[model samples]
Structures are given as C-alpha cells and as structure tokens.
Target: MNTKLKAMVVDDHPIHQTIIKQYLANKGVNATTFGNVTEALRSLQGNTYNIIFCDLQMPGKDGIDMMLLLNKHGYSGSVVFVSAMDDTIISSLTCMCRPFTFNVIGKLAKPYFEDDIDKLIACVCDKHQSKASFQKQIEVDEREFLVALAEGRVKNYYQPIVDTKSGVLVGYEALARWMHPIYGLLLPYVFLPIVEKCGLSPELFDTVFSNAIQDIKLHGIKHSISLNVAQDNLEDALFSDRFLARCSENNIDPKTFTIEITERESYSSNVNLYKNLLKLRLNGVSVSIDDFGTGSSSLEKLSQLPFNELKIDRSFIQGITTEQKDKNIVRSICGLAKSLNISIVAEGVEDEETFSLLEEYGINLAQGYFIDKPMPLEAITVLNKEKKYV
Candidate 1:
C-alpha cells in the first residue's frame, strides 16, 4: 500500500460514499468524497487524484457527463465506475471511457463484496504503476509521412493468416511498417493517425498494395492477401476502380485480394461506402468486417453490409483462455457468423490452447504472433517456398 496514493469517491449515496472511503482508508489511500459532479469538478480544479471512483446515476450531471468533462479537461488518471447499473450499461460505459485515453480500472456493481474493493484497489495500483513506466511516444506529422513515402521507407510487412485446424497458410495480412532512420522500425500506430488526419490514406494504401503485389509475384504465393481499407477509401467512388487497375497492372487477380474494414472507423449510415464494398464483392474481391465485436453498431453493420468474413477482435480473443465471459462472447460470435454463412477469423491467438479452442468453436481462420509475426517480403517469400511456420 502506498500512503502517497490518492483517490476520489464521487457518489450521491451516503452509504456508497462511506463504503468507498473505508475501502480506500484500508488500503492507505488518501480519499476525497464528493456528493455531486459539480463539487467533484471544483475539486478537480485544485487537486490531482490518481484514481476516481464515480457513480453513474446522479441527480444532475451523470457519470457519463462527468467522464466526458474529465476527458475534455485532459484527465489522465484511472477511473473506476461504482454503480448499480446493469451489466450491459456498465460494460458499454467501460468501453466508451477506454478510447478517451483514461485507464479504466474496472467496474463495481452495487452491493459489491469486500473482495471487489480489494480487486479495484489492486487494479488501480497496477495501472498507475504501468502508466508511470510509459515513455512519451514521438509524435509523427504529415511532413514526416511525405518524406517517408518519398524515401521508400513506408513498407508492407506480411503476417500469415492460417487455417485453424491444419495450420496451413491460407492467406496473408499486409501490415504497414515504417523503416525510420532514427526509430529503426515503427508500427502503424506511430504514423497512421497522421495519415488519416492528413487524408493521405490513399497514398498509404498504394504503397501497401504495390508492395503486396510485388511480394506475391516474387514469392509465387497463390493465396489471398488482406489489406486494411480506411473509411475514406471506402467513401471514394474511384477507390475500387483504382484498386482493380493496380491489380491488373501487377497481374494479380482481384479474387486473390480481400479488403478488411476496421471497426475503429465510424461508417455509420455511409451509403457510398456500403455500395463500394458491394461493388468490390461483385468483382470477386472479398470483404471482411475486422475487429468484429468491439464496435458500437457491429450487428447493424453486419445486417447492412455484404461482408463475407467476421474477425473476432483481439481484445476478446486474448481473454478467451482465462475469462469465461470472453469464451461465451466468442462462442456467440461464432454461432452468429455460422448462421449468417460468414467465415470467422480469430485474431490475437498466441497459444496452442487458444488455437485449439478456436478450432473447437469452428473458427475458419486465425492470425496472430502464435502463427508468425509480420515478416519482411524476403522472409515471407522464403516461408512461402518452404511452406513452413518459423
């Protein structure tokens, strides 16, 4: 227990506030209690707390409102939702807060046990420690992206997507990587946001597409290649035509290409994107809904789109071995995809046990480090020739 640790409890109920305060006191945490969000906001002005235990259903401004306010004010501390809300609402709130760059410690339902408080305290301490150890990442800009593109530093790395049962390579996913002179190697997270912000997704796509075609031809790998398609690309009327032209120029069949639409992109009611996706499918290109279960309107998108594949998000897949809830969720997704005649690909399967479980669940395909890390073009070519997993 760190005596220097500080936390705030924001709850209207006297009993709930007392319980949280006592729990914090037991853990040697300096705790502040606020009965309303207004006073909490005032407290935040003059003080900094490492963790905040917030209640959802309050008199005036609700917990969601407070969280949004906290995000707006750039609160970086961990937040624990202590509420009586149903599991679905709590889970949704948890998901909502995570993307705002806050460490969501977890949730405690009303009538929580002593163990729940203990777990919450442990989670906060762990997250705080992890956050403390995080290094400030280098921010990338549009100029750097253009320079990288011109210098031929923007490249594609291939990660093998395999059949769950036989472990045979059925396809490969093209992951973007940057060979930065200073940084050595950088993943998509470093520069993708800048590309998206600058509306240069097409340039990035072109680089990956060109590299993928070259890799396939060089290796003579007769399998599908999946590339992430940004929402901007989908919205562009000429995107499909441009992509087909590239395939034709490279002597690559459109049937051997798959476009993966990520859940992170908000494609809500974008009719043009839907039509373009449909057009691609009509032209023998496969479309997959990537990161399947994490999005807000997953079911709606599935209902509206002509996606032939559903990729269970890594977040759920990573938890399948340890969490029953994750297993159930994945099982449900498998059932739903099967009913729709959609192929299922489990992402982030890092162990034989997980791979076996996915196979049992009838997952059609899988891609993760357990199969192979994203390899360079030469390495992919060698692996294709050998027909072996390294």
Candidate 2:
C-alpha cells in the first residue's frame, strides 16, 4: 500500500526550504522543495501535491503571481505561506486566493519554528484522514429535510451567556441542531443552504424557535434567549407578527428574546427586513448584530440601523490575551458600542484571561466554551433551577 501524501515547499531561500522539508519529514512526509514558484509550476505539470508551503517574495513570480497559474493547472491541494510578512497581510492574501480557487490553509510568519510548520502538515493529514468520519457531510435532499422538520428531528441547543462583571447567567443563544440518526448532528453550514434553497428556512426557524421558548416557559427559565435570525425569515413581511404571536402563545415576553443578524448581507436594501426589524424593536425585542467587525460596512450599518447589541466576533476575541492588535481592536469596539449606547457581547470567550479582559473593557455579555457548550434544554433547565451557572 503506497500511503504517500505528495508535498512541496516553494521558498526562495535554500535554508528556509531545508527547514520546512525537515518539518514535513518529521511528520513522515517526504516533501519536494522548490527554490521558486517557477520551478514549482514546472513540476506541477508532471506531479500533483497534497500540500505546499509557498513564500510571497520570490524574485519575479511570487506566491500571489502563482495563484492564477496554480488554479489554471488545477492544483487543488492546501497551501500555506512561509513568508517574512505580517500575518494580517498574509490573511488578506489568503482571502484573495479564494477567488482563484486556491486551497490556502494558513501561514507561518518569518522565523517560525518547526512546531508552526508541523501544525500545518498535521492539519492537512488530519483533514484527509477524517473526511470519511465526523467531517463527512451527508447530503439529504429537500424532501428529507422537510421530513426531518416535520418529524421534530430538528433540535435546539442553548449556550449560556453570562454578564461579564457579575458572572450571572444573562441569557442563552439558541443554536439549531438537526440530528441525523446515522451521521448524528449536522452543523448549520452543512444543512442550512439546503433548507434555504428548498424555501424551508421559515418552517425550520418556527420549529426550532417554538420548541426553545416552549421549553423555557415550561421550565420557568428566566434567562433571556437569542435566536439566530435567517435573512429569508427576516425578509418575510409576517416575520415579526408570527414571532410575536409565538412569544405571546408561550406567555413569554418579547423583551426576553433577541434576534441576532449574523451575515454581512443582512444589511441590505430590502425594505421588508428593515420593517420587520423595526416592528420587533417596537415590541421590546432586542436586535443584535453578530460578528460586528468582520464586514467593511460595519460602522455604516451601526449608523443606519437599529441595533441594541453588538457582538464582537471570535476572531478578535481569540487573541486578545496574547496579541496587542487584537486587544486594541477589542477595546475600540467596546468604546464604540458604549458611545452608541449599544450593549456589547463577546463571542468565543474560551478562557479566564480573555473573560477578565472583556470584563475590564466593560463588555456586558460573554459566551463560549469557557462558560458552557450548547446543551439540550433539559440540561440547561437543571442549571437554571440550581443557579449553578452563577
């Protein structure tokens, strides 16, 4: 059995290439090294690689220059940058590769040690190994999604959010869980587009939302609850009406529920979206803009819309403890949210250090694995009763 994963390293410097090859070798991967992208391109004619370490500065044909040609050559393997460049700039370049169909995994800044490169190699290997397991995506048709929705196979799990200063459980975010009997839980990324394409987002939303609030009411759960609002449902003229009716039916206050907008495109020219959002606001339901700093028009959206809460995305939160740039951005966002009188919630709060920093910065609410993972309603109801979360 030939179990070789073809790998390549493209660096202008011979020493850098040697170090990377050694790292790959440590992972039991014998990598072919190229002094420049030109040679790498020439080799691509005869052989395909499973992973490539590319450098941005290589005389004439740099990594950016290789993007189009690589795609033209149908190179679909994962690529990581081994360049003497700032990680931020490298990240932007990686995004640029998506347009050209490049499978960029990540980057190793200048002076990266063996551990850095080894991590990338391990990622490619693990991804290849796990594609047939948990990472496996089963495509269920629109009809099956409808059947699942009708059969109540779509479940709701709530992740607890806490008040940063008081350490009191303030709310829970209702994450939709569609459990397939054989494959188990299908993440939203796997199942949602199909639901949207099948024009069944509204139905799915109602199923999840109705179940969540009904559970909350039955258990006398006092914490506020958040629902990730899909644009399709938000655009419906009857959205706010139906949402409010459901709350009323459950004898739950609209003020206890929040609708979160996650997508950058949620800030659209669509009038119905705005109208429904306004109606929700008028009824005392809060609206939060999730992943606040990710989009180009985030500030403009803040000025143009009615948002009661701003959620700082996890990308910024993850590094606040170690990265000064992350701290600076988090501080600025907190200040801006304060000035606008909008409460700020920090998502992806995974440690005590980050949570303390967020509290010091006056973040109102925080949630992540540090606090708790999303769990079934029965589990959270027990916590609510015992006040264990506080």
Candidate 3:
C-alpha cells in the first residue's frame, strides 16, 4: 500500500469512468482516465504507470489491442482487464501476455462493486516490493571464479523438501551458491560449467561435501540431505573411496545423504562411474535422477541406472494446475515411478495450489520456493525444531 500507486483507467463510458476515477481517488491513487486505447497509448509514450485499468469492449484498440502493443511501447506495468468478457476468451488472451513479458494481474466484469476493485488493488499491492538495491552485473571469467572458489566463497545453501501428504519436513537439497564478496550471489549455471571445463569439478564437490558435513553437524540437521554431483565426480576412479572415507571420518550415516544426478550428466559409461554409483548404493546413500521429464534420455537413463528416486522438473510441476498436458505428464511420471518402486519428488512448487495437486498426484516429496527458498543453515528454523509446512 505504501508503493504510491499510479493507475491508468481506460474506458469509454462516462458514468463508469467517473465511478472508477472516484474510487481510485478515494483510495488515494493518482489515476489518468483515457476514453480509448488510442489515447492511452499516447499517454504511455514517455510516461509510465504502475498499473492500467483497461476496458475490454472499446471501439478501436480494445483491451486485446492495448495488451498486444503495451510491451512494444515499453510499458512493463501490470494490467487488469475490465468487461463482461467470456472466460474462454480470457483464457486464450492470457496466453498472449506471457510473450509480452507482462502479467494480467486481475479481471473484472461489468457492474462490479467497490469490493471487487479493492480486491484488484490488493493484488497490485501484493505484487509490490521494497525499493530494489542496485544489482551488479553478473559477468565472470575463469580465473576470477577459481579465485572465488579458493576463498570458499562458493558455499552450500539448503532448501527444504517436505513430505507431500503429511506436510512434514523430510529432507533438504544442498544447492551451491557463489557468495562472491563483490559480485553478490551467483548461481550455479554461471560458474559450474566453467569449473567443469577447467577440470575443477571434483575440487568444487569437495568444498560442497565439506560444507554439508559442517552445516549438518553444526546446525543439528537431522533430515535427509541431497547433494548434486558433477559428471567428473562420477568419472573419477577414486571418488567412491574418497567419498566413503569422508563419510567415515564424519561418522554420519550414508542414508542421511541423497545423490542427485541430472538426466543429461549421467551419459558417461566409465567403469568408475558405474562402480561409484553401486558403491554409494551399497553403503545406503540414496541416488535420485533429477529433472525427470527434461532429458531426452530419461527413460533409458532410468532403465540403465539403479535410481531410488525420480524428481519431476519444475517446468512440468508449475503447470499442472492450469495445463492438462502437464497434468497428464506428471500423472504418467508418478505411475511410472510407482511401478518402478521409486519415490517421486516435484520441485519448483511455488504455490499452494501446485503443492496440493502434487500431493493428490501422489508425489512423495516436494521442494521449491513456496516451501522455502534456499538459505544459510541458520535461517532454516525447522532444522532445530519440528515444523509442519502445510
């Protein structure tokens, strides 16, 4: 509410205009009224509004017309369409906004009440955030990355993974982050490939492995912890011996750890690769195939390897609530994993609706932003105390 909302009301009817303008005025919103999309676009030329209250049924350049050109005119603010537009047409039009990189924040029919307008206003308020700090550019070179890693700037941040049915915390996936002193937080995709290309993947894994052990012991993290392994870590002949040696030194149960192998990275047919995987399994560490539906070799990889878990990628999980195709894909994956006697996890579950559908789909575990964002071990309060997420 403190964002200082500015709105553009596009409507042709004089009475509706007066009513909407009055409502906005009451709410302390600075609103500019336009009788048509043509006038609205003219106002948007060099000016920007936080949101636009657009009418659907207009003479030329209706709601659809305005939306199609909004991004082209450099208007990145959110939009709310007003009219008695059919739900079917609305669904179809919603797809168009994605390409324009703007969101249809809300919809209202004709003859709506003040409460409905207030609801849309609530949506706008919910989307606002505190003033953003200046973001430094993320560009990085190899030597700088190596220096950062050497300084122990690349560390593990854990995100919670919960049991879907009980909504109880079951585990956490240890993800890597570059806590660069100057560059801030740099994600894996930025530096991981560089590390792998420079044949430093095992070194990076050593850092993560050491950090996970230290965090679990220091934080008293009792839940399962999953760590992602690079392809090189598997290909190395001594990875298994070194890994088991560390686990023995720490005196932690191997069952407490899960190794996540992305679908694309497991193509190596090294004897050491197969040996390491088998040795880890024999020692009681669970192995999971991450990003289930994303790879071309998903089924073949599952068949070849002795995987204990299958993780449905977020790309598919996020769409199940709205896309029938995604729902069907997840259902098939769940059935396949069940048949294989394997547990399933749906990651990237950001909302309650998605999580509920995943639970209904028989997902054994779920993880993503909705459950929790990855953070330092100290920030995960449930690690120290039992907590229910649902």
Residue 53 of model 3, lDDT score: 87
**Alpha-carbon deviation at 238 in model 2, angstroms:** 3.3
Which wins on lDDT, candidate 1 or candidate 2?
A: 1
- Per-residue lDDT tens digits of candidate 2, residues 71-102? 88888788887787776676577657866655
lDDT agreement with native, every candidate? 0.85, 0.83, 0.83
TM-score against truth, every candidate: 0.70, 0.84, 0.70
Model 3 TM-score (2 dp) = 0.70
Can you list the residue pairs that collide in candidate 3?
none
* Ranked candidates, highest TM-score first: 2, 3, 1
Best by lDDT: 1
- Give the worst 10-residue stretch by lDDT in candidate 3: 128-137
Off by over 4 Å in 2: 1-6, 27-29, 41-50, 68-77, 98-105, 118-129, 132-137, 269-275, 319-328, 350-356, 378-390
Please give, for residues 1-390, the per-residue lDDT of candidate 3 as tens digits: 443888899998878888888887777777889999888889987786878988888897788888888878767678988888676576567667866867787677788677878877777766654323443567788998889778988888999999998888899899889987677888898897798789887878888888899987886888899998876788888888888888898989889999989875647567887899999999998999998887788988788787999899887898788656678889999999999999999989999889888778989999999998898877776444655577
Off by over 4 Å in 1: 1-5, 11-39, 57-65, 95-101, 110-137, 158-170, 182-190, 217-224, 231-256, 263-284, 291-306, 312-336, 347-362, 367-390
| Predicted candidate 1 versus true structure: per-residue lDDT over 314-390, tens digit per residue | 98897678656777899999999999999999899887788888888899899998889898888876777786652
